[model samples]
Target: MDKVGETVLEIDLEALAHNYNYLKSKLLPKTKFLAVVKAFAYGSDMVAIAKKMESLGVDYFAVAYVREGVLLREAGIVTPILVLHPQPVNFEQLITYQLEPSLYSPKILVEFLKTAREKKLKNYPVHIKFNTGLNRLGFWETDVDYISKQLDNRDEIKITAILSHLAASEDPDEKEFSDTQIKIFKKISVALNERLGYSPFRHMLNTSGIINYPEAQFEMVRSGIGLYGYGNSAIEDKNLKPVAQLKTIISQIHKIEPGETVGYNRAFSSEGYRTTATLPLGHADGIGRQYGNGKGYVHIKGKKAPIIGNVCMDMIMVDVTEIDCVEGDEVLVFGQDNSADAFASSAQTISYEILTAISQRIKRIIR
Candidate 1:
C-alpha cells in the first residue's frame, strides 16, 4: 500500500490469510480451528476478520461478549460463535443470535438453563469452562458433578464443548504449569464426560500452545494474537505476518531551540537545535501516555523519530532532527517494517496491548 495520508490502520487481508493458513497447518486434519475474534479482532475489525476466517472455513469463532457475537451474526456470519465471558443479562440475546456461551460457574449455568428453557429451546449448544490453572473464569474440577446434576435430565442445553484458558503458554519457564493445567483439564474432561454420559469436544490451546504444545491439542484450538501477527516468540513470528499496519502523516514541523519545551507540562525540553514533527494521534488514539517523553518513537523516512513530549489527547511530537523529512510525510507508527512488537517494547508493553488499544475512530483501510 502507498503512504497513508491520515492516521489509519491498514488491515492486510492477505496477511491475515497467511497467518490463518500457517497456524492451521500445525493442527491435525480433524482438529477444529476456532479463531478468537474478540476485542474487535484484537483492536482490528472483528466483522472483517471473522468474514475472512469464515471464508477460510474456520470451524468456530470465539468472542468475549454476546454483543460481539451479535455483530458477527448480524453481518451474516453463519459459523458457530462461542461467547467466552457472557453475562446472564444478555443470555436471551445470546440465544436469539444463536451464539453459544461458555458457562463457567454454577450461577451462570443455572441462569442460562432457565433462559434456554424459557425460550423453549432444546439441545442448545453451550461450552463448559473449567478452571484448570488460569483461575480466572471457570468451574473447578469438583464442579463436574454439580454441572452434570444440573443438566442431568434437562434438554434445554447441551454441553457441546469443554474449554479452558492457559495462563502462560508463551512463557517457556511456565511449561510445567501449563502441563499441569493441561493435565487438570484432561482429568476434568474425563470426569465431565463420564458424568454427562457423552464426551464433549475438548480444547485448551491458545496461539502459543499450538506452537509449543501440539501434543495437548485435544479436539479444537483457538488463536487470537497469532492470527493478527505476533506469535509470542521471535521464531514463530517469522512464520506469520502482521495483519494491521498503523500509519499517519506528519501534521506539522517545528524547529525547537535549545531549552525550549515541546509539549504539555514542559515534559521535553530540547537540549540542542532539534527538528520535531507533530503527529495527529495520541492517548485518545491508543498511543498512551506511557509512550511519551522520549520513550516511544515513530519511523519516518527509514529513521527513528523519538517521541519527545507528554503524549497529548490528540497529538504527539517526535524529535525528527536527524531525518530529512518535511510536513505531511507519511510516518510509520507500527507496521511490517517497524513492527508493533518493537514499538510496544519501547514502552515496556506487549504487542497485544498496543494492537488492541488502537482507537476505533481511526480509519481502517482494508487491503
Candidate 2:
C-alpha cells in the first residue's frame, strides 16, 4: 500500500472476482463470455486486472486497439483477444501474437484478408462488426453483400464471430430504440450467416444488452463495465460489485478567516472561519476541475468534506471545518461511502466515464 505516492487507486481483485462470477451466473450454459479489458481495464491496472480475470477462467478478452492486445500478449495472456478497433498497420504484430482483429469496414476486411493471405494463414479467426445503430465503426447492413462477396474470394480469412454495439441498451426508458437495434442486429446476423455458408458464433449484446435483453444473447456475450462491477442492466441487478477505490491522504491543514479567497483565481471565498484540508490529489490525477467550489466532496474521517476553490494540477483543498481530521489522515475519494456512481452523479457523468478517465499516473494498488 505504501509504494510510490500519497494518492493511490485501490483495486480489489476479490470484488472483481465476485463481479465476474455474478455476471457469469446471468449467462446461458452454452453462451461464451468475453471480458473487455480495453482502456487499461477501465483505467484500473490492465496487467493485474487481466491476470486476475484470466486466472478466473475468463473465456475471452477484448481490447480497443491492437497495442492493448499486444500488451496483453506480452504479459503472457494466451486468451483469445478480440481487437475491437484494430488498424491495418498493426496487422503483422497482431497476426504474430495470434490476436484476432474486428473487421468493421470493407477496407479493413480487405486489408486484413490480404495480410492473412500474405502470411500464408488459413481460416484465421476474425470478428465481423456490423453497424446497427452505434454508427461508430462497423460494416453497414447495406454493405453486407459486398463484404460477403469479398470474403468468398478470399479463403484465407475466416469470420469467427459476427458482433455489434448497442446504442441505447442502458436506457430502460428507450425500449423501442433498444428493440430496434436488437432487431436490426438479428436480421444482419441471419443474413450474414446465410451468405457466408456457415454460422459462426454471433454476439451483439454488451454488458447492457446482456442485462436488458437476455433473449438476444445469441452465442456469446461481451461484458465490459459489468465485469468491473457496474451493470447497465435496465432493471436493478444487485449482482455486480464495484472493484476500484480512489483514496488519498490529507497532506496539510489551513485555517481561513472570513472574506478570504481560496485557491487560484479566487474561485471560492470563505464566508466564515473555516478549516480546509489539502489533499495530495487534483485534476492531474483524475479529479477534474469541475469538482471545485463545493461541487464535489471527499470522505474525511467518515464525514463529508466539500471541495473548495479551483482544483490544481496536483492538489485540491476541501473544507473540513467540522471534521476532526489531521495531516496524513486517510480520505476516501470514491469508494464504499462515496461510490464511483455517486461521484459520477455529482460530476454530471456516468460510472464508465469516471472509471475510464482515471489517469495511468496514479498508483494502482492491487489487492
Candidate 3:
C-alpha cells in the first residue's frame, strides 16, 4: 500500500478472490463457473488475473478472440478456454492451441468443420451459441435444425455446451424480456439436445443475470464484470471488492489568475485565482477527451478536484484550489473508496467502458 510514484494500476489479488467467491456463491452447487478473461481481463492484466482464477479452481475461461486464448495458453494456463467470437482464419491456430471456438453462424461452423476434418481430428470440443436476444452474435433459435443437419454425420467436432447472452438482465424494466429470452434458450437447448441425441450443458447468465435470475442458472454460469468487482447494481456492488485501483502522482502545480486558461486550445479560462495540479495521464492513457472541462474529477488527499480544460494526450489538469496537496502527492483516479462506477457516471458512461478502456501501457502492480 505504498504511495505510487508514477501512474500505475494496482491489482489486488485478494480482492479478486473475494469477488470470484462472492459470484460463485450465487450459483447452485452443481453449476459450473466460467470466468471471462477477455479484453485483458477487463483491462487489469489478463495473464495475472487468469492465473489467479485458475488457482481458485475456475471451471472454464472465456476470451473474445483466439489470440487471447492463445496468450493464456502460452502463460501456462491449462484450463479449457472458449473463444467467444473467433474468425475462420484463426481456426487452425485455435485448434493448435486446443482452444474451443463458439460456432455461432453456419459459415463459421462449416469452415471450422473443414479445418477439423482436414486435420483428421475426432470429437473436437466446441460450443454452440444461440441468439436469444443479444443480436450481436450467436445462431438464431430457428437455426438449430440447420446446425443439426451440418453435424448430421460429422464427428470431427463435439458440442460441449449451448449458450446465449442476456441483453438486459440488469434492468428491472426488462425482466419480462429477460424471462422470454430464457424461455427461448430453454426451448432451443431441448431441441438441440433431441437432435444430437445427447444433452450438452447449457448456460445463459452473465454477471447481472446471475444476480437477477437464479432460476435460469442452467448448468453453467459466466461472470466477467462481476469477478472484476462490479454487479451492475448498487446493492450488489457493496458485496464485491474492486480489484483494480488507478493511482498516479501530481506531476506539477499551477497557479491560475483570472482570464488565464489551461490546456490545449485554452479550453478553460479561470474566473478567479485558483490552483491546479497536472496529472501524468490523459486521453492516451484511457482518460478519454470526454472527461475534460469539468466533466471528470480525481481524488486528491480525500478531496474531489474537478478536471478543468481539455484533457491532453499525456496530461490532465485538475482544479485543486481548495485542496492542500502539492507536487508528488498521490492521486486516486478510481478505487474502492471512489468506485469506477461513480467516476464513469460523472461523464455519462458505465464502469465496464472505463475499466476496459484502460491502456496497456500503464504499469500494473499486483498485490
**All candidates in order of lDDT, best leading:** 3, 1, 2
TM-score of 1: 0.99
Q: Each prediction's Cα lDDT score? A: 0.93, 0.86, 0.94
Q: What is the lDDT of candidate 2?
A: 0.86
How would you encode candidate 3's per-residue C-alpha lDDT over 1-367 as one tens digit per residue? Answer: 3787999999999999999999888888899999999999999999999999999999999999999999999999999999999999999999999999999999999999999999999999999999988899999988999999999999999999999999999999999999999999999988998999999998899999999999999999999999989999999999999999999999999999999999999999999999999999999889999999999999998989999999999999999999998899999999888999999999999999999998899999999
List ranges where model 1 is wrong by over 4 Å: none
What's the residue-level lDDT of 214 in candidate 2? 89
TM-score ranking from best candidate downward: 3, 1, 2
Q: List the residue pairs that clash in candidate 2.
A: none
TM-score of each: 0.99, 0.96, 0.99
lDDT tens digits, residues 1-367, model 2? 2333488889989989988887778789899889999999998988999999899988899999999999999999998999999999999999999999999987898899889889999999999998888889998888879988887767798898989888888787888887898889888878888898888898888888887788889888998888777775424435667789898898899999999989999999889999999988888888889888888888877888989899999999999999997888888888656778777777687788878888888888888
Candidate topping lDDT: 3
Candidate 1 steric clashes = 0
